[model samples]
Target: MQHQPPARDLPASWPPERTAWLNTGAPMPLLGLGTFRLRDREAVRLSLHAALENGYRLVDTAAVYGNEAAIGSALRELLPRCGLSREDIFLTSKLSPRDHGEAPTEAACLRSLQELGCDYLDLYLIHWPGTQGHPQGDKGNKERRQLSWRALERLHESGKLRAIGVSNYTIQHLRELLASCRVPPAVLQVEFHPQLAQSELLDFCRQKGIHLQAYSSLGTGQLVGRPEVVNVAERQGRTPAQVLLRWALRQGVSVIPKSASPARVAENSQLWNWDLTHADMEELSTLDCGKRYCWDPSSVA
Candidate 1:
């Protein structure tokens, strides 16, 4: 039988100081396992186990992802066996577009918490600024977003959510939210990669002290084959995925790169042991061409 390596010891501080601190003072892992589109029950269970076993403590899911229950099951079964606890992990989930109004938003959060079998989430997010069943140009959409945010704020105040934020929010949406928000968003989750750098938004979030969490950080696998990324990978003797993830880490943005394969999950978690040179960072920065692999929220308003 082939010998498998023992799981790495959980660090005293899992992600170290590089991890971003939320406005609520909670530490969020800079790297996590993204569960977007990871819907199959067995697949999610196996992947969650593999990710946790490899030392991934941050797991991102959403009401729309349809796998929170699967992840919950995995955690219930795996945590005790792995010698970890609920507090040892930073769990995050999002409110779906369908649940944008105040009442529906609260209900959605409760359902998500029940499904995940957790009493409180480390972080919760407004999955998108646009509301479901509403036209994009409808003025009511903005009101719906505000209502949902208010619900999240209440949840955060009630201690059901340690931190609250939004995903796919552009500068316009953020400005609108900030005007009346009692609790400023602690994080902003968005699609970020070498191709779609969104430098302006990144600057805005940094100035506001909102940690940017990146989804689709690999550009949905399109970036791995790019000449610039490949060159950097070859020089560093790392895989293209690792090179891309390290680039995001170096920029101080949190990243959640999902993979069903155990080997890839292990490979993705090895970013902490190396450093990327300034020249390499500069070269990768030049690859930005405004390419977007996921939904564009720029036109939402």
Candidate 2:
């Protein structure tokens, strides 16, 4: 097999940070490289290698993303290059809503584990409440999500996953799980950025001892041209993407920004050097338009 060249052109110390402990006592880096749409096996492998080489300890992927195999390859190859063991990394994966039922969910999780070639997941999440017309949510997506949560809890109990979480969940869904769940979700992954502040839900998660993991923290390229973000980036002498990521980090949220470009992957990790002032944080807070770049699960009801 031919080896791909290194992806990033940055120095060794990219993230310049330590891992963060979740509510469940699992440790993950505050900033991670997200492998959501890096579908190509070689590209995903290259990107993962670049991230691990540059200083990322947490790796976020999903079975639905269809790149677990590539991520696994990267892990196998790059862990040796970086001189780190499996215990040095925090690997996260998710179960698709289609696999919400107990048996299917269990099967899907095991497949993710096998595909990723990892002994266990640092975190496993219920990808989302099932879509309206999907088979996973025939009765009610919310109820199905609860069932999936239970399944994840079982996996945690069996030591297949260190911690459990949910993605794209609203406060109502989170509150429901909190009320009835045996083990509360350690993290709530969500589509959060300056344009979709999610203040209410964020505060709720904070109070409930759930870490809010921000996905699409750059607003899926929307922040690249936004005037506010551009201005902030200029003032801070960083890219708009970095500014957006810093905004999320300032709010004490963990962020996973995906980028196939080496420069972007490196830039995304260069957010810790500067601190956004109180006014900067307050200014970006007003940019929330409640614009959801992804599907709105609430409309499914």
On TM-score, the leading prediction is 1
Clash list (residue pairs), candidate 1: none
Expressed as tens digits, the lDDT of each residue in 139-173 for candidate 2 is: 57767777777788899999999889888878877
**What TM-score, to 2 decimals, does candidate 2 have?**
0.91
Candidate 1 shows a clash count of 0
What shift in Å separates residue 264 of candidate 1 from its native position after superposition? Answer: 0.5
Point out the worst 10-residue segment of candidate 2 by lDDT.
Answer: 1-10
Q: Put down candidate 1 lDDT per residue, 130-244, tens digits, no spaces.
A: 8888877778889999999999999999999988999999999999999989999988999998888888999998888788988998999989999999999999999999999
TM-score of each: 0.95, 0.91
The count of residue-pair clashes in candidate 2 stands at 0
- Give the whole-model CA lDDT for all candidates, comma-separated: 0.87, 0.80
